[model samples]
Target: MQSNHKKRICIVTRSLSEGGADRVASLQSILLNNLGYQVFIVTILNSVSYPYKGELFNLGAIKEKNDTILGRFNRLLLLRKFLKSKKIDIVVDHRVRKKPFSEYIISALVYPKKTIYVVHNHAIDLYFPPFKWLTKLVYKKSKAIVSVSGKIQNLIFKKYGFRHLETIYNPVDLDYIDKQKIESVTIESPYVFWYGRFEDEQKNLSLLVDSYNDSKLKSQGVKLVLMGNGKDKDKILSKVGELGLTDTIVVLPFSSNPFPYIFNSKFTVLSSRFEGFPMTVLESLACGIPVVSVRYDNYEDGVLKHKHNGVLVENHNSGALAKGLNLLVGDEKLYLSCCENARKSIESFSMEAIALQWKNLIEK
Candidate 1:
């Protein structure tokens, strides 16, 4: 909180590319930069598609060139030296800490006491390894562990008994959305949208296809637009073709600026098996587009309101999701009401409000 103290913060994550957690890191860089902080980003991977306002240190380039054991060790040494050279005041780490030994080294040698680990999924082991003692040993020394949902916060506590954990939902970058939403798109037909990787396990891409096939939206001439890339693209396309809904279902690659498409869509849908707090859902609501998402256990608590802002399908089954799609698109009055309430529903999650929480956390 002291003005005399330099606000030099650096974010450590996988990449500033296509992923919900990665996108949040990119937004944080912009938010911190706008607040007059000296911001820097250190991406473990070289992939970068999202726009960010900070200097980037791409460690992935080194690993790409030489992926030997010696090269990996060198990357670790260089990461530590890079942080020290920048004299980073705070480190907001968004990387998935899967390997226990690597995390131990990073926690013991690389990161400082001001580091904050952000958990972005319900799969707690992805962020904290399965070993409870090791998880506590590495993470307990940090400033705090932040989860994007209250459910994840509780899971962390119940699983690991960490008292320093807190929940900070993903903030929607309204200013950025305002600028991006106005970009022109060539799509003519009104479509329901879903954008993310084509992975079938986590994102449940087949559920999206099956539900769309069963929904009346296609019969009523509302198209389904899917935007993203992954391993299951061919499988998803094949399923769509088999169902004879290929023409009705439009599949496109991921877009860095997807707001224009989202802004013009009738609504958005999320069928993910689980998520911490998806950026797409927040971005959809921020774009004044209501979302119809399949609810996962203990998730969607704060973000999705059942009928006020969006429809939360009671179950993850394809039939339930199909019914939800029909209800939201079938009932004109409900659809319009949700659309009208969408933007305001997420006002509390604006970048400024969430940034204030980050500022408080850093100062306190």
Candidate 2:
């Protein structure tokens, strides 16, 4: 590809804050730029710093004056005009189109020659009823539909009747993850680390916490480390306090870099009820850390294999999660095997490899 003749690619999203989709957008922009593509990121809300090392253009913030009838129409008008003026070759929209109403508006107004919609959630229940008609119309108009996992693609096809969707697993930048020379942090006893937001319901933190509290692992000094802040932090903290796990559990906020913790920890745990291929699993594997995840449709097949890279527990089962954690932390040989396998498993999903995938797809 000629450097100067590089295609102008724009990624449009609601925001660039901490999330898997946002991170993917940033990484794609950086990788595409390195491959000699002129990239621009347009945000409809919140000005988030471009997390990728590439050229980023913010197309002004979304101005919502009030909840008046004219106000809504004016905002849509502004967005439509902005889309027309950009004259970009491709526009990739990354946002949930739950209701057909909004999808209809976006399809009718912001018409691009090649518009791609990337779906990152599997909640089919939310895409029906009030906006059923609009939803079908928008999907029909979409040039390409991208899902983060095969599970999501299947859900879209089976429930929503969209068969043309493509599955692209989230990519990790192994190059940026700093692997520390320090040997794993020596804990006097084995510890089970859960490094993510404290939202007990969605993240299923309570399941892990209750399981650990009632397991033999607790008697053996298996500690739970909770990282990342959220709306439910206070409730989680209170629950921990009530359970008298203040000494056994630790809660921390989000980190700009979470690799050091991943490196020091023995193993990572993901307890999400649902996911669109989480980047955290990829990040943990890149750092040579094993993971124990709730068996989700996509993640089980993609990341957590029986004993290969990580362990997959039955979904929403505290006992299963606890058992998986105990096995990894208690059995030294199994832990080592899992760590080694995790490191090897992530080779194909590295940034360079994924960039080539994106390049081939875009150029096609």
Candidate 3:
């Protein structure tokens, strides 16, 4: 078989910030580049924070006065021209098609010929509200649909008839995580750690604050560490202050390497309302730390196997979520059991294994 190493590949996404998919795109670019392919990341907003091995193609540089109708049309048309001129082979896009007139939809218009759509969310309801028909149109034009989890794949096909879909779980760079974990770090206390954006809509971060504020863990001198940033950062910080947890709740900035934080934490906690497959849980487990997370489609299956690897909260409410956190952080026997199985449970999702799946998809 002739090798495709000399072939050019492009990954299109809005930016590498605020979410896990962007991180996945960055990791994929690095892995593909290492595999001898010429990889290029085409980010609309140049907001890249994650590490990659590819040359960046920032379309956000070519901007106008504002995002007017004419401005959008010009950007879309020019982007199409640029993609065509590059003669890229197999563009894999990891962005949600927002609307009929958005950049995502515009790319969907041009990418079907050479693009495989990677769906990151558990559902596409965030973007499709008034124009639900656009969902069908976006997928209809996709060469193939790659869901991050089997549950997400099933959810997509169940709503919209069967299509060319495949489930490729997110890749966790275990080597990078392990290397970072050993690099001496300092955390004053054995805190209950939670990271990712402060978005209450998806992550439901307020639940964490409420639960922590009311929990016996705080009275016992255990701290709650909140890291990462987003649009709702100020609001969340303010909520913590209002609840008089300004000292108990420690908020830190977003980090590229959070393994050290996860390594030293008592146990990780997730209060997400919904998720495709959270990277934090994967990374925490990879570091031999258990997680107490809200029950979701992906978390319960192979990772947090309900007291096997980590405890699963049956409800999304603050009380239920707090109880799960307390169980994992407070109980020594169960916490030790979860920690014993944590690293072993997520071995299949390692970057080495999952990268092969991506290689097959890209070559196909």
Candidate 4:
């Protein structure tokens, strides 16, 4: 007979960073903890940026400072033994694996069952060659598969022939964004904001900078502030300088609370190559800022409803994006219309709403 008590749950993440998935992982743990579940966050690394309301286990901290063969094996064994002993009801796996071998091995050993893999990308393109096939096979070991957006679920079904999959959009902690008033780090200028990891390949920041440069918006003294740091920061920054846009464009490190900037800006912008569902767009809407973004593949399927709430460029061309940006921000009536209807568009993605979905999945 099942005990009438809180079910123990664990969320496994690589680390907490500015990445959309990282935010989702930490937010889920906090939500579940608040929902009165026995929650645990098992992070592979110690660099946690977000605060959570559950027990946190930093696997990195337990291992010896010096890397010895035996020490590494012992740590792995310890992790497996610990989880087994605790008898976790479920393990929510949120790490995106670039390679299949290690993930498959770990799942077979530590997560043989009762594990749910949360896919957070345009899954098919993120992999290479035969490993993609192997990765799909590895996912079979999980108790269930969840896609961050419906588009990802469709891709997985078509490619891997998976029968069942759940599409759960990333949740926005509305209470935190609403109540955490930021009195500091205010952007006085009426600017168009863009914030995300500085990585260019997937995020397509190069296109955003070029499009911003191509547009005459910068001439109006409406600054373009790009937030979040990554390995590609210096390269993107150098490009910003090369295009003679250092003064017009600004790059800032990720802020713990970016709502004030989003709420005050003329509108927010994005130019991602692809996204699992785009937390930035959802967060931007939650803050009541109209969005302007390229119509990446998954863009249409989620967050962006075009013209209704935000402007969507037809293609990724700089000229097209520039024209779209100028149209959205330059036209007073259109921007006002979008801003008025912004928050209403994403009410379904509120933290509480998404948490209900997760709760249903967990209890099922």
In angstroms, give how far residue 102 of model 3 lies from its true place.
2.7
Error of 1 at 248 (Å): 0.9
Best by TM-score, which number? 1
Q: Tens-digit lDDT track for model 3 on 125-239?
A: 5423245565676556655788887877887787776478888988888888888887655567768899998788888888889988867888888999999999889999999
Superposed on all Cα atoms, the candidates' RMSDs to the truth, in angstroms, are 1.7, 3.4, 2.4, 2.8
Better of 1 and 3 by lDDT: 1
lDDT of 2: 0.71
- Candidate 1 regions off by >4 Å? 1-4
Taken over the whole model, the C-alpha lDDT of each candidate is 0.87, 0.71, 0.78, 0.79
Please, what is the TM-score per model?
0.96, 0.86, 0.92, 0.92
Native-vs-model 3 lDDT? 0.78
Question: Which ranges in model 2 have alpha carbons more than 4 Å from their true place?
Answer: 1-5, 47-50, 53-75, 124-130, 179-191, 197-199
The stretch of ten residues in a row with the least summed lDDT in candidate 1 is 1-10
Q: What does the lDDT read for residue 149 in candidate 1?
A: 87
Q: Please give, for residues 209-248, the per-residue lDDT of candidate 4 as tens digits.
A: 8899999798788889888988899999999989998888
Candidate 4 CA-lDDT value: 0.79
Q: Is candidate 3 or candidate 4 better by TM-score?
A: 4
Error (Å) of candidate 3 at residue 338 is 1.5
- Stretches > 4 Å off in candidate 4: 1-5, 62-75, 125-137
CA displacement after TM-score superposition, residue 360 of candidate 4 (Å):
1.5
